[model samples]
Target: MAVQPSRPLRLFADYLRLERVNLTERWMKAVFNDADLSESDRLTHEQLSDHVPEILGEIFSALEDQDLDEVEPSIERNARQHGRLRWKQGYRIDELVRELDLLRQVLMGAIDSFAQGHPTFTRRHEERARHFVDEAISFVTLTSIREVVTERDRKIDEYTGQLERANHELLLKQKLVGELYESRMQITRSVVHDLRNFLNVFAMALQMIARAPARTNAALALANRQAADMKTLVDELVEYSIVLGDNNPLATEAFDLRVLFDELVASCGPAIEAKGLRLVHRFDPQLRTITTNRLKLKQVALNLLTNAAKYTKVGEVELDMRAHGDAHWRLRVSDTGVGICAEDQQRVFREFERANQDDVPGAGLGLAIVSELCRKLHGELRFASHEGEGTTFEITFPLRLDPGG
Candidate 1:
């Protein structure tokens, strides 16, 4: 293998860098000083600024020329310019001289040797110089554009994710607060009804005792009646508190409708009697083997029935249950009460809502609890009513009883 001369090559590359600098300096100086000179001087300055670089580059073809003697005049003219106008000032022109010398040395006798017909080293040196300048410009442009694009994409991604997170947090807070307000309203309505019922029963008992002829009978009856009324109110309040727990766990079980209906009717008699309304319940005993949380379902049923009794005036309140299939049943409660207005129907399920025509006393969660309970049992509920006529709530509960049993 032939060994390469590395030191000669390094000097050769430096030579090209200085050559371009010298050419650039001459071109700028000629443009500034000779822009308005006389026509002949203008021609001379244009050759120095532009035409000379082209003539010198002709060395590659000059090497192929059979007569290299004719190119001598141009080279000698360039050499003379380097000594006179090109190398005039000590401070300003010294830079041009240094550049010219550096360029001449890095040429490394290539042009001279090529002119002397040494073609082996010429093409290689030309390629090396062109590649260095091209690559340097390309690398700088690519680096700057890449940095700008990368930064823009990063900021866009961060902003999109930030907005999504903010919206998610807002929805979560809205849901939590709504659940809280619902629980408080349910508790308030339950307390109000229980309190009123207790007071009414107490008043009835006191009046009966006050009319008694004997002191002994009046005192004994008063104490007993008051105790029973207090007990009933306490029981109802406890059940309401259990259902009103925001995170309460309820038990589902199988129960007969005949037994459940009788208990509900007897338990709610005081509240119904106080409102001067009659209560009616209709359920199918054969299809009543339903699997549900008996206490919770009972609470739901009683609340609906009681609300009907409280709202309706001079009309009968009815609770009716029917078997749809082995898989589900429909429980419909209709009242001859003040019907819910169409505009207020949607808002009736909202917490703390009371209609403008709603003359009854109850917080607005009776239907909301019914809706939630229906969801827990995999059921569906709907209602229809006419204004001032009556309202009918229809619920379809899945039959959770063992189908194959």
Candidate 2:
């Protein structure tokens, strides 16, 4: 009723058992010698060799039983462990792939050597052995990659949970602070909803790939892209949360003003170009250095620039910085696009309040954050907008943040 493994297969299994150490040594030598696997140089012998011996034993079991299914679970377990270990050791996926490829080559070479030494090992036996080793190596490669992906998914889920809990706690704190909490709570809800949508898309893509692994490359790429977008949103949410709280104090330092705007322009250049919009910036050549919170100022400028780039479908976004009298400096961001109507002008700085929420892609917190930062910096935030024309936002901050200094 059942077919037993041939004598050659049985003897091959015994050869694997007796030569496991030799096989492992050869693999290690190969890995250490590989230029792409240089990361292995940092690892101790035991760390690099972890779970590999068990994988060889499982390979031996597969050859002995003539059924890969009988030993696959154990193989998977060892392979997963090896994968996680490699990941923690800072191994890139390609490097892990290269490492495993080396192992496959080494094993195939060993199989050929074994065949050459034994007269009983016929051509048919050699082909079968090569097939078995190839199957095991292929399975190992897939399982290792899957385990890494699963780990990444777990981390993203954990981070999203943490952000949700932090937002909840922030809402409670804002509630006790004042009645303004209602508006903030609404903003928080909108942000969470948007984040959940991205996460859902990412999760669905991952599930589809899991179900049909053969068609995973494209789906995996989509998943990674969605994950990246989610991270960007999460970072923005964190910044908004910190701005909402009163605990974060301003850390001011005197830095070159020209250097700051130059960096900001460079950062926003790609996004502006994507929309086919021109970015025009004019900095007063006289303004060499300013004593202020460089990080907060950078954040404020970035938010304003990105907001302009997002809303303006055509024409140019202009950023201007000039001296306002002798006491202060004026920073203006103006965009040629659909402007805020007179009716919606009053609530422009309110949290989660967007005039064209449906037509635009934003959480409606850009101006709100800008308003809060201006208040913290003790500066004035003013804007001029026409219904069908364009909008200009300007902030006038004292030249010296500490008036006494």
Candidate 3:
């Protein structure tokens, strides 16, 4: 027996077809204009609009057919492809879902708008159309999400395996260098402690995603930020481990002091701005070039500047470069933040020690790493702090580092 499509649905599908071009334009505008999809700003119109028109066409066809069975395969294939393309475009899972959700909203809005204009679109007709449209959009959403999840899982597994192997080798080497074992253990305990604190916040954000659907975007953003912070912690830990394990001589090179500080200032701009703080820097006119391990120098300077920005709430962070003497120069980082108390001042250089860990967002390794690198570069690190005033960290280094130094 031949089954006939519903006349009302057929007419509604025709209306959708007529408005498909307009709907696609609306979807593109909605996505690009959305603040949550800032990543799309980097993409061109053609790249962002890929496969969207086709997806709309599938929806319209399914509407006309009065059954999704005829269009489900096409929808799945197109959606999977769209998901892969978005993945390659650096779209996060939340962002991928977000864009499509916007599309669904656009389609729903169009359906309501159409129903309002047509006297024939009765309450029953609107209900049937809404249910069908929702089903079609759900199919696309689930298929695309599955594709993205599969790829992400595969990449995570591969990276996890590589890290495991690297960890095993590192453990063997650490065992041979028995002196480094205690330092590494301190770092591990500190990392675990900080990670537990971060994970608690992350889990709470995930839990809120379902309980408060209105805040799903906010929750997802929190999760992404937490993940990024964790990555930074792991990277810093690896760099610290390398610094600890290294016994080789320092690598010396000549680099411009002004250029180095300029880069540091630029890198610190975003963080400083986010907290509504100012970054002020000055370089001695006579200090043109210095012969030293520029990389280590920059690392130490950056760690200090980053720490300054992190702790300062209402005032400016300053970086001052001055010629200490004919043979030495000093780098100073001053911040108007909650200064270290007299009691906690002695432990500032110790590994995994923080005066206010509960309120701060560091793994407590910045100054320790700064102290270690200062010794390696033959630089002397000194600081002055007052409980309510602020803190100043100054490192004095020789203008030229000899191989033995």
Preferred candidate (TM-score higher): 2 or 3? 3
lDDT (tens digit, per residue) of candidate 1 on 285-371: 657577877766776787778767767777678888889877888888888877888788876765445445433444445666676
Q: Provide the lDDT at 185 for model 3.
A: 84
Stretches of candidate 1 exceeding 4 Å from the true structure: 1-162, 171-240, 246-250, 254-290, 322-329, 350-372, 375-379, 400-405
**Per-residue lDDT over 1-405 for candidate 2, one digit per residue giving the tens place of the 0 to 100 score:** 124789988998899899999999999988998888879999888998999899989988888777888889999999998888888888888988898888889888888888888889899888888888899999998899888777777878999999999999999888767756677677678778878887897888888898988869878887887777666666766778889786645677888889988998899888897899999989998787788888788889999998887778889899898888877898999999788999999998887677675446566778888998888777899999996678999999877797334
| Per-prediction TM-score to the true structure, in the order listed | 0.44, 0.50, 0.53
RMSD of 3: 28.1
Best by TM-score: 3
Better of 1 and 2 by lDDT: 2
RMSD values for the candidates in order, in angstroms, are: 19.3, 27.2, 28.1
After superposition, the stretches of candidate 3 with alpha carbons farther than 4 Å from their true spots are 1-184, 210-214, 357-359
Better of 1 and 3 by lDDT: 3
Stretches of candidate 2 exceeding 4 Å from the true structure: 1-178, 199-228, 246-249, 355-360, 403-405
After the best TM-score superposition of candidate 1, give how far the Cα of residue 202 lies from its true spot, in angstroms.
11
